[model samples]
Target: MTAARLGPQERDAALRAMADTELDVLVVGGGIVGAGVALDAVARGLSVGLVEARDFASGTSSRSSKLIHGGLRYLEHLDFPLVREALTERGLLLSRIAPHLVRPVPFLFPLRSHWERPYIGAGVALYDALALSGTRTRGLPGHRHLSRRAALRIFPALRRDALVGAVQYWDAQVDDSRYVVMVLRTAATYGAHIASRTQAVGFLREGEHVTGARVVDLETGREFAVRAKQVVNAAGVWTDEIQEMVGGRGQIHVRASKGVHLVVPRDRIHASSGLILRTEKSVLFVIPWGRHWILGTTDTAWDLDKVHPAASRTDIDYVLNRVNAVLKTPLTRDDVEGVYAGLRPLLAGESEETSRLSREHTVAHPVPGLVLIAGGKYTTYRVMAKDAVDAVAHGLGGGVPPSVTDRLPLVGADGYFALWNQRRILARRTGLHVSRIQHLLRRYGSLIHEVLGLIAEQPDLKQPLTGADDYLRAEVVYAVRYEGARHLDDVLSRRTHIAIETWDRGLAAAEEAAQLMAGPLGWDDAQIAREVEYYRARIEAERAAQEQDSDQEADAVQHGAPDIVPQATTVRV
Candidate 1:
């Protein structure tokens, strides 16, 4: 009924409302799928309460390859339906859903030999066709065959002899973390009660029927009960843990597959378009970010820490070696600006290799009260959410409305095109550079006015964050004021992506951000200092962990930085 701005006051009010009411659906986990589930349930006229232990998208959702793409490589295994579904979702996101956040990106898939050319070409053609068949297909160009010379013109950084030819195909990319936040915000706008930094301790059961859950406010040491008719567990990698909380082994098992990515300056790669190369284990992507390039993804089984999946020296070397195999000028550790590792929650199967495991999601009611949804890629999060909510509806034993999320645009999706067209006028009116206005438009879409309003209120906020010029100081304030960023890491890591974009990993801007956040969060000078110190220590710990050779060693080093949320309250069950 009212606009849902996820500020501190709004979060507190939501948490109070959640504890007091008997919701129709209580969605656990604040990752993309969980956020989607909350939105779907709320949109269907259900009273919904969504809770997260950490910041929204604090886990794998934020740490992904940031692509909303159909897995073209899946065609090799004849997973046509999965690929098609993902492509259709990608089309929807690009055109109808979050058009401002999701945009088309081109990738050059290099062909190693003459025979490989036709094989890869046919697969790519099918990928393009699948996208076009989608009802909401946008204006992305189809795949095209490019000779070695022609491909070189687009990607001169490629080694001349690395490919016989290349197939340029279309996909889409997003600020994965921001998209999740937007989804949660949209759900809140539709009357969903949402709270982050709220950990679910255990399920509240009335003799095997899940009626609700006991949750703790990690920010404070307060515990409360949220009652719901049905509880949906969309905890991505933590699916198994939530199942255990329900006192069962559960019907499904989720395996953690760690994938690491590297960030380098855009100039270091010299590519007009993104590059996708085949690897021994899986495919490697060198995605194009605005000022930097995202080079990633090493697929390997991880049994260590799920919270902080550290990127070890070996992991970094593996990505570098894979990308270096194709680059004319090799990229070493020095060229790397940042590194992040995330675990993919795969549905365990007969295959030993994690990459070979199924990305298709499985939904099951493990117990009378709990519904578990696990194992899907980022591209099809909405579908997974819809399926999970449908299960909840069945349990409720009523004519619950069908999911309308397919037609529902996120908060900023509407009026994005018109806003973009008037970017020049907006820049002039705001007394900001056109480039800065464009940057804000891309990140916030129609919400740019809210950010500009902050700058208007505080003229000093127009200046960029100290040492992190890419972001304005007003954006940091905004993280706390509107985006529910309670801590420095929440702003640095998720709300703005300053952590991965900067070489210092957001250390240089940590203090300034903490100061900006202090006023809104009501932090005293002492609290501000503590937050800054904690952030600095986190950066230091991450740097030390990256030098380790193995996951165990990296995890050990990373844990040296004490968690801001007290361990006693993080995961009680």
Candidate 2:
């Protein structure tokens, strides 16, 4: 297979190719499901083209709780199939698809009462059993019942009175944004035309049959019609808006559920394993991220500002209050390194609460040539993609082959294990620490050479960013030259995660990162300054928004910072 390079050159070439050729499948939205759809279609011998309005995974996909697990909470609702399917996909991701990006992480579920032990224990046992039954290799250890003292041994920072016992179970975590980019790269390798910062302005139709979409390149403001046999609307939260362009009442109604997460220094929570605490509405996860603890996720209905979902002061306080209820040392706003908010695209159901909405996705031929897929969790993105492509196949008169994505390993997965085992040798040869090589292995897998090669040409690239030492300078250059990072936010927020891991929210690294990015993207001094200023303004707006009391107020504050890439005005056909 050819190595897929999604650099600026490739992106320009893709847009031109998309305009010139009529594709078998045109995928709108570059989130997890959309990327999955592109990969699935192209791998199945179909010509595919994917367009994202902004940077890839810049929406809900980047801002997930970062877990790849069967929804343990959904088992309470007796949704067995969803749990089983997600577990199967999780197993595939860990064992086959993207082992470098996905790995098992243990979570301790504190048992409040004696009865709660067996209750939660049984649920966890069932979870493990379901995972085991789904795939040949479960890819993680089974759940363990722990005494209060034993639990405290694993999680020293837990409040003693919080629980009598605990249930420790395994779930996988991933760099959500990175995984999306890898998936798109993998898709591109299979001949999918991938273009970012491109928006679908309107649908192209002929006598009531949707034939294609009229897309505008946000970077250059060039509008062109991308002709395709089928169009898949995998636009997550923007599904309704996409549907409106075609003047159709979408069969599927998607509601946005805002989930906010707080990132703090790793020292703040001295837990070996992550924590999953039950809330009145849902479960709150204290996920273990590298050098930090990610405490998150308040499930509330959101009706405003889909582009940048803002986390309010109330949202922050709610998470702190819930997490502090069980922590020996309470966390404060000052302890928070960064905060991010994302919206979950939920299928509207009979329940009034957003938490109760269906996570099971639906694929519809709302129009003859348009296939819309919405309302699935991140873990089951592959299944969602398969289903969406199945609809596309039906719309194309059914000669398309079945999906081969389940057997396909993503780009970095092939030689990851071999390279990981030789990390010491790589470290010695590159004159870097083994730990740094390990970090690079986990992030880029076998593709570490592409990054290291940059360091070899310019040895200074091996040095770490001034404020965010976790990432090397070479990684920033690689993000633009290979990973399709179009802006400063793309590098800091998604590609490297300096924005959420740093104390100043990447403010210190913004200028340096922009300067590094300038050479490859051909940015002048003014453009570099503008990129830094926009990033600073964005961080400022997010900080101010977090102080607001309500979502509306937070949305207004967040909207105060203009987007670096101007949003395409949807031209109704």
Candidate 3:
């Protein structure tokens, strides 16, 4: 069956279809796991419909450490199974599934003492050994112990007092937001009807069971009664809220912990390999991101604003002071170009500290028609998706085929490996630099042809974005056309790398991006200008908040600007 892509006009048609019939699964959220469940369920010959209140990956999925590791720290907690499962998925991602997106990254774990050398080395050794046991991991290398001399060869920026030696371990990195977008697209390709900016308000109940849901289209003030046999709630932070919607108290407690990261020029930390420093409470990473190095991530408890977690001066100072302990050239507040904060939906447990909460995700049948999933790391999102869909299968009320999503490849996965060999030719054909082509390949994988097609049609689209020059103008159009981008920020921030890549943090490129999306989304001159100004205000508020010393102060400063008008905030465009 050819899958449906719900264009703007088709929104009414799509909602009508939803109201007129029954679906096997109605996924409430549109994050990584919900998308995965929709894809998995549809591929198994079930009818699937997924809706997101915001753009795809607009939440925690978009803001991540960008690593797809097997959770090396989880081993310290003796969660060997969790680590192994993550490694298995990591291998699958690097080798077969989304190979274009996930790639190997070596991390240097500095050993401060001589005893630390053997202790950490043994842990990393076990980590790699576990990967070797997996099917798709043989292509990657094993762990290597680095002498103090050998370690300095790779990272000369390390302070002499920082380490006695280092242990190098292999992991993977990804564009978390792009990956989720890909997940949504792939699910759509498998015959799932997905519309972003569509909110599920209340349940459409039939006697004791929730036969469907009452939803409001955020773009147009239209109401919908989307009918389905099963509704899967993959809303990360709002799982509890969704539970309350169905008159059920949440079975599992999910506490939100804020993790903040800062982006600085790569030269700030002169290191060939990524740094994974052990903090007193949690681990801090100085991961290499394109032309910049992204760092910081305090695992402190945050109960304030979950939607916009602001990075205060204290948070940034803590990360800088901790990571700078090992840097030969220390980083100051001025070195920071961009800072972002995300709330982690940690599975609530007995541990008083947020850092101690389990990274493991769980699924529960909150009601006969509703299934809830939350609290997992980005790397293991596939497992969480699979598990959520599996729970949905029980509520389908028929003999349904088993989930074969593990064997199923994402839409762009098949030809991505082949695209790698012919990237130079692709660059030559498109009149783009090999570096630019490589960037698109990593982001879009085999779907680079789709992005390239946009450039080919409008030759001027090949030009790079003015302020956020690393991204091409065609990417902006593609975000609106294919990736379901609804607003200016959606194009500049999540769909492309422009947000964190630029020094101004996408403020300069916002207008151009909005203009590109306007044709597809149908925005007028006044609306486009409003979008640009709003994004500038958001960036300004965040910058002001980052200057504050404490979370409460930061939250006060950040939230002072005003509420962001998400399309779902009202119903009209």
TM-score of each: 0.98, 0.99, 0.96
Screening candidate 2 with a backbone cut-off below 3 angstroms (N, C-alpha, C), the clashing residue pairs are: none
The CA lDDT of each predicted structure is 0.91, 0.94, 0.82
lDDT of 2 at 21: 95
The candidate that achieves the highest lDDT relative to the unseen native structure:
2
lDDT tens digits by residue: candidate 2, 247-279: 856898999999999999999999899999999
lDDT of 3: 0.82
Model 1: per-residue Cα lDDT over 1-573, one tens digit each? 234799999999999999888999999999999999999999999999999998899999999999999898899999999999998898889889999999889999998899998789889888888777775567479889999999999999999999988999888899999999999999999998889999898889888788999999988979999999999998999888888887655888999999999999999998899999888878999999999999889999998888988899999999999999989999989988988889999999999999999999999987777889999999999999999989999999969999999899898878999999999999889888999988998888898888999999999999989978989999999888888898999999999988999989998898889999999999999999999888899889989999999989999999899878763333323
lDDT of 2: 0.94
Instruction: Evaluate model 1: give its TM-score.
Output: 0.98
Misplaced by over 4 Å in model 1 are: 569-573
lDDT of residue 47 for candidate 3: 87
Worst 10 residues of 2 by lDDT: 134-143
Put the candidates in TM-score order, highest first: 2, 1, 3
